[model samples]
Target chain A: MAKLTMTVNGRTLSADAEGRTLLSDFLRGGLGLTGTHVGCDTSQCGACVVHVDGQAVKSCSMLAHEAAGSTITTIEGMANADGSLSTLQQAFQDHHGLQCGFCTPGMVMSAAALLAENPKPTEAEVRHHLEGNICRCTGYHNIVKAVLAASGQDVSGVGIAAE
Target chain B: MYAFDFVKPGTLAEASEALSHDGALPLAGGQTLIAAMKQRLNAPEKLVSLTGIPELKGVCAGDGGVTIGAATTHAAVAAQAAAYYPALAALAGQIGDPAVRNRGTIGGSLANNDPAACYPSAVLASGATIVTNTREIAADDFFQGMFTTALHDGEIITSVKFPVPQKAAYAKFQQPASRFALTGVFVAKFADGVRVAVTGASESGVFRWTEAEAALTANFSAAALDGLSVPADGMIGDLHGTPEYRAHLVKVMTKRAVVAAG
Candidate 1:
């Protein structure tokens, strides 16, 4: 085992991770920050997306030791300091963005990264940016709605009229 | 994934020394290597992390061409190369996805030389130079075949220098699932001549289409490729497409690239 040290959600965390331990496993199993999901072990799925040094990357595709001395931000780090939902999280809740919620953490993280880079993304950009993250619920209608809304865009009448 | 020794070398000299060890592999971005390790496809006894070497990570544009550090991530290339080479930047932007782009490096992509990868097409078409620790190799001489490069063991790719072309563009038909090219074509027009490279279609690997290049050299337009079609015998035929289909796509994508270049 190798000793690893990194900043996660603003705290310096250390653990003994094997050479092969993935960043996803370290965050979820070793650190107890289970919000980062690993839907597909392959690199195709972005369900384990997180910010490493402010850039969004798939955790499952990176080794935990490779992330040493880096700053990592996960779904658990997105809440407001007062322990309330952040604006983006609130947007998801207000728009009913998730159903089964298995892919929410990953979706939120990807969207937040997009917003961080491109603050006012178009609906088309949101869909394009989400190509890596897969969702089996909501058909991504409200998810797109939630992202646009979080960008402060008027997402009224954006999705199908099933409501 | 099997347990292995991990070492982050702070300098290129140290990294090169570490890579000289038997069963030691250079780790960059870890986008492809880590995934291969997870599937037990590769089991290097030691992983020499090159991320700590600051000299291997940026872009420098000169009058002759643009030189990009081998370790520069695709995302960085997309954002920085836009001003100098829009077509190259666009190609980088469309690779895999946002997350994959964040972790995948140009060097790793070139070294892995995945058959369907988009970089080889650009590098070959642009006549780029692949610089290593010991020597520099031309793009035409660098890529050997699918997942193979001319790089010797223990020699690390330091940077790639691309000559500024007067006009260039890359067009690709994604495989949909992996987002890798089902068929991709890159067309570049330099002062001397036109070069065309095709990826994801050939069974032997990425190759320059002499017919397309000769035609484009005379006309430099999509209409130049009207009667040209790549032979189907050597084209790749898999679940994504048939040999004939890929052959047909070669013409279509090349024409699209020419039009886009203008």
Candidate 2:
């Protein structure tokens, strides 16, 4: 087993992971960070998206040991101090960005990464950036609305009514 | 996936030695390797990750071309190669996705030699050099066939050197499901002549469309390729498309690439 050391959600965590341990499995099972969901277990779905060193990456496609010494941010870390929802999270809630919410963590993480890089993403840019992220519910209308709204874009006629 | 041991060697020598052992596979980015392992497609006894070696992760421009470190992420190439090789950067930017591009490396893509991969077309069209730890292999002699390369056991790709062309562009017709190329064409024009490489359509992997190249070399324009067409005899055929369809696409994509290059 390799001793994987990394800072996750602003906290340094250590875990003993095997060579076959995926970063998604390591985060959920080893460190108990269940916020990073594994919807597909395959790399195609972005449900396992997380920020490694400020860049969005699919955790399922990365080995835990390879991510040693890096700073990781999950959906859990994407909140303001005192555990309140950040602007992005609030935008999701206000925009009805989720229905079952199974894909919320990954969606939120991916959106945060997108806004970080391109803070003023357009509707097409937001949709293109989220090509890897898949949502089974809500038809992704509100999800796109949430991301665009979070980017401070006016989403008045963005998608079907958020209701 | 079968259980395996993992190692992250800090240098090329150590990584090579680690991979020299039986059932040890070098992992770069693990975008494809990890996914394959999970599917029980490739279960090695050990994984030697190349990410730990700092020297294998960067980009530099000189010698009339661009040199990209093997482990440099596609995101890095997209951001770094923009000013030097805009077409290459554009291709890199559209690979897989924002997240996949963040983890997938140019070396890993080239080494795996995925038929639908974008880098092979770019590298071949640009006449790049694949630099391994021991020797530099020309792009023409590097790719062998589907999921195959000239790289031998324990050999590691250190970087790829891409010669900048006077004009270049890549046009990819991608499958919606996998986002891989249905038929991608890269057209590159150099001082000597023009090179046209087509990927995702050939059964033999990425190969130059020599007929298209000759026509474009004589006159670098989409009009030059009016009568030129790829033969469907050896093209890949699957549910995505038939061999004839892929062959037709090769010609179409080449023309689109030429127009874009202009």
Give the CA lDDT, 0 to 100, for residue B249 in model 2: 97
Chain A accuracy as TM-score for every candidate: 0.97, 0.96
Model 2 agreement with the true structure over B1-262: per-residue lDDT tens digits: 8899988999998998999899999999888888898889998988899988998999899989899999999999999999999999999997898899999999999999999999999999999999999999999999999999999988999999999999999999999877899999999999999998999999899999999999999999999999977789989999999999999999999989999999
lDDT tens digits, residue span B160-240, model 1: 999989999999999888999999999999988999999999987899999999999999999999988789998999988
- In order, the TM-score of chain B in each prediction is 0.99, 0.99
Every model's DockQ: 0.86, 0.88
lDDT of each: 0.92, 0.92
The best candidate in terms of DockQ:
2
Candidate 1 Cα outliers beyond 4 Å, as residue runs? none
